[model samples]
Target chain A: MKSFLKLTYMELKLQLREPVALFFTLAFPVMVMVLFGFIFGNEAEELLGGYGQVDLSVPGYIGMVVGTIGMLSIPTTLANYRELGILRRLRATPLGSSPVLWSQVAAQVLMTAAGIILLFIAGLAIFDLRIPNGNLAIVPAILLSAFSFFAVGFVLAGVMPSARTAQAVGMAIFYPMLFLSGAAMPRYIMPDFVQQIAGLLPLTHVVILIEDLWLKGTWNLTSVAVVAVVLILGLVISRFTFRWE
Target chain B: MTQVIEVRNLHKAYDGVTAVDDVSFNVDEGEIFGIIGPNGAGKTTTIESVIGLRKPDGGSVSVLGLDPQTEARKLGNRIGTQLQEAALPERMKVWEALDLYASFYEKTVPWEPLVEQWGLAEKRNTQFGGLSGGQKQRLFISLALLNDPQIVFLDELTTGLDPQARRATWDLIRAIREQGKTVVLITHFMDEVEALADRVAVIDHGRVIALDTPDNLIASLNGETQVLFSVPNGFEAERLEKVSGVTAVHQHNQHITISGNGPLLANVAAALAQHNIAPADLRVQQANLEDVFLALTGRTIRN
Candidate 1:
């Protein structure tokens, strides 16, 4: 436990040192939130379900945070560590592969949470959005969703051959999901066919789950099941095929 | 002598092609063992297997009486490795890396001294990516010795280092051995082995071709000292072969070449004096490990 904590501390410090990771995990989400607020905050029209744009856009930014950290930040960081033999160097010590990989996930998970908080503060200050009912209930849902997305990152960390490939693969998946899942724009603006396709992707589910929790103050039990299944599948695939090269 | 590491008939392959086959070696306590070979000759692969980085197909590897494959975690406390290509987090500070690596061991030496000893005291606050190549190499050597392991493996450790830094690293390695630690040095640089190895294993095609001290390996190749000089116009240069200890003599234009095992230069000088031939452009060349390697493999170590 001591060693794991030490590893986690170092991992978090190292992650914070990376400008690219900082951009994806923290600054990007905050940027998106402020932009969404400025563009659509003051209007009283119903853009997201029944709330104003600022209230609706908060969940989308959270989903974007998860997506950026899971798809772009975590996978690319792991791939770079592997390709550059940072993982191999650790293997020579008492701290083996599992601890190092887990440390990365833990660090990114914390960063995702921090990004969400930043988005929340920015939302409240800029758009005058209020916190929804049942503030404590959001923690479990956020954790499960983060795990579900981190599991997806683990799969990318396993399959991608290089950091460049990981980045390429991450961007390939991230942008489309962001646009289609209503993370980049209001979901009401998306066509019905686009919304159906978005529903099939995991990011859309994350956004909806966060949206429902923040707006309606109730659990979306069906989205929880979907996330649980993905979490298991991602774990299995990554465990079986993860490469140290 | 205590054997710190023992390997028997290790075999490994990748993607249906053999990388290491039938390789075996032992490292005794407190000795610098060098492994030198041409590219793709499986030197790195052999080291990886012995260090438990790979699972061997056919043989057993034991380090400090523990199975490397099964007891790597246990062995990790006793051994250290500096891989051919490795890096820390780019923005990690020097002191942070030293302290972090120090934490991996059950017992650790004070890292403050390591920083001073390695000439990295001022660079402690500098990020890893900001360091020069030599500074990075010094940092790696310091990190490898951080745990004060009983045995250490270093592979291609000084490939890009400057000459002064390379010399410092060699001295640092010797200092490690002076503390009664064992080392396994893998490098393609013959000069590095010649300067540092107590004994070297010459590997080729995944097999140990010769295992002996550097002097013995060069001697076993029948390497000869050569005497080259331009003979006075008409003096018979070939006649120097009759002088004791000269084995082969050849003449190209006015230059006479005399090759022999021992004291050939003295004998040839005497023979020339006897003939009253004034030798000009006098030169003597002794065979080195590079020449021995070329003779043994018929190929250069580097592409």
Candidate 2:
């Protein structure tokens, strides 16, 4: 346990020391949130007709944060570590193997929290958007979604041998989850067939839970259960396929 | 002497090609043992297997009576290693790497003295990528000895070093032995083997072909002497052969090489004097480890 904590702290410190990684994981997400919030302003409601009656900026910013911090960040970091032989070197030491993965997950969690807070601050200050109705429920819902998406990213990184392939794979999953989860385009506006397919994705359940808590002031038990199952499945797949080299 | 490391019929294969095949050897305590072989002779594989980096397909390997695979963490604390192709992060500072590795061991020598002793004190704040080849090699050696381990393993320790650095590293190996730590050195340089190894095992195709002291291996060559000198005008090969201790003489265009058993150079010089043929540039070369390696493996160590 001591070795694990020491090594994990070392890994985190080394990663945070890199300005490039700091920008990508921490600053980039917040920048995207601000950019998208301005672009979608009050004009977004008129473009999508009545369904866009709800200003899509807040939910959209949250979704982008989840996607970037969870899916894109996890796979790229793991793949880069593998390619650079960092993972191989760590495996040779007495450090516990699981801590390396967990440290990455922990960093993502911290970044996601910072991103969410930044997005909220930007939403209120720049877009004049009010806080969501149920602050208590929305927090847990967003956190659960982050956990699920990060797990999926971990599994993707573990299974893919190369960083380029992992990046491509991460995007392939990320964009669709963002677009179909009512995060980019609302589910009510999409074609019925597309909605049915999106419903099967884990992100769809997360978006549903977050939207319920934020806009409706109520938690969706069914959506939360679905997200929980998907999180477990992702964790299992990652554990079985993780390769140090 | 107790054997600190023992391997029995160790076998390892990668992609259907065997890297280490039925190899076995024991390294005794407090002795500097070297594994000398050409490239692709399975020297690294044998060392990695003993260090628990690679698992043998079918054999037993024990370090200090502990199974490396099962007890790697415990055994790792007691052994220090400098891998041939291992490297730390480029952006990591020298002191950071030292501290990080020192954290893995249960006990470690202070990094300050080690930095000064390894000549890395001036580069303490420099990143690993900024170091020269010699400096990097020295840092690797320092990291290996940080734990003050009972056994130290060095793989191809001086592969790219210049002659001066190589000699300095050889002295360090001797110092390690003097400290009563068993050293297992792997290198293809016969000079390094001859200079520092108390005993050496030459591995060819994953099997031990010769194992003995440097002098013993050279002396077992049956007194083969090489005599080379420029043949003077009117020197006859038959006269050189007729000299006592001269087994054969080969003449190659102004140069003569005489091979024989006892006092071959003296006999050749005497015969040349008798024939009034004083050869210029006379030289007698005694057999060394390189000659023994060629005799046994039919190939030079470096080539």
Candidate 3:
């Protein structure tokens, strides 16, 4: 238990050391939120189903936070360690490899949560973001979003041949989802066919689910079911694809 | 001497291809036991099996009198391994790596002194990726020694280092032995075995072909020696074959080569002097481990 904490702490420090990853996971989301918040203030807009622009976009940015950590951070770290034989080295020790893995997961979760908190504070301070209507389901909805995306990241980390490949694949998947899933831009403005494709993405479900819980205090059943299915599939695929060396 | 490791008919295969065939050897306490073989000759597989990093399809291995397969966790605490391809994170600092690994064992030596002893004091804060090859090796040794283990396994420890770094690593390995810890050194380098190991197991094609002290293995060659010198053109070098301990003589223009056993050099020199012929470049080439390996495996260590 003590070693787990120590390892998690070290993992966080290492993640912090990577400037690019730090910026994308923590700073980028807040920057995008601020940019959109300034351009379109918290005025109720029919284009956003009557919710204010910042209020509606805040939930989507939170999805972006969860997606960045899941698609970028987790896969890159694991694939790099495996490529370098670091995971195999740790496995040979008395502690074995499980602690390293668990600690990594813990650190990523903490970083994602921290990113979300930073966005929340930014929205509240500058844009006077509307609070969720006391729906406790918002907490679980955010956690579920993190879990669904992280599972997909693990599958990518397991299957990718190297760190560079994992990063490339993650970027290929994440950028499209970020924009088309309405996490970066409103999907309502996109073409009908593009919106149809966005509906199939897991991040789309995370965005819709979190927004529903945050704005209307009601669960979107289809979003919940889709995210749950993605979580299950990612878990199953990672089991067979994961390689220590 | 107490035996700390024993293996019996160990066998392993990967994807239906044999990696380690019926192999066995014992490591005695307080001695550096060397396992030498060419690339892809199953040296790493043998050690990994003995250390419980691999499971053999047949036979058994015991380290520290504990079954390596079942008691691997317990054995891991008592043994230190610096594997051939294993590495730490590139961005992991030397001190952080030490401190983190030190937490894995139930008992550990202070890492500060360990880094100092291994000449990694100055590199304590340096990231692993930034260190030179020699420094990375030193940090690995320090990590292996952190648990204060009774046995240490170093596989191909100095394969890529320069001559100076190799010799320095040899000294560090010797220091580990001086602490009364049994060391297992694996390499294909002949001089490494000659310089450090008390006994060597020559592995080839997934089997133990020979096991003995370095000198004994070399001597097992029946004392084969080569005497090379240049004779005058058209000289009858064959006449020197009758010299005591001289087995055969070959002449190639001005060059004469003699192969025999004990004191063949002196006999050939005396024979030449009696003919009033002297060669300044005369030298005796004694059989070493490389010769022994060639004689045993019918191939050189490196392809």
Query: Which candidate gets the maximum lDDT versus the true structure?
Result: 3
Native A-B interface contacts kept, per candidate? 0.69, 0.22, 0.69
Q: What DockQ does predicted model 3 obtain?
A: 0.70
- As for candidate 1, its clashing pairs are none
Which stretches of candidate 1 lie above 4 Å from their native place? A42-51, B228-243, B248-256, B265-283
TM-score of each: 0.92, 0.83, 0.91
lDDT of each: 0.85, 0.80, 0.91
- Candidate 2 per-residue C-alpha lDDT over A7-124 given as tens digits, one digit per residue, 9 for 90 to 100: 5566666667767666766676557656655555444353444222234545655766777766777787787677766676566555546766777777677777777777667656
Give the TM-score ranking, best first. Answer: 1, 3, 2
Q: After superposition, how far is residue A144 of candidate 1 from its true place, in Å?
A: 0.8
Candidate 3 interface RMS: 1.0
* DockQ, every prediction: 0.67, 0.34, 0.70
Once fitted onto the true fold, the runs of candidate 3 whose alpha carbons sit more than 4 angstroms away are A44-51, A133-136, B226-260, B263-284
Docking class of 2: acceptable
Tens-digit lDDT string for candidate 3 (A1-245)? 77798899889989988889899999999999999888978887786677798888877898999999999989998999898888878877888767887798789989988998999899889988777666778789988878888888989999999999999999999999999999998888899999999999999999999888887888999999999999999889987888888
| Comparison by TM-score, 2 against 3, better one | 3
Poorest stretch of ten by lDDT in candidate 3 chain B = B231-240
Query: Per-residue error at A62 for model 3, in Å?
Result: 1.1
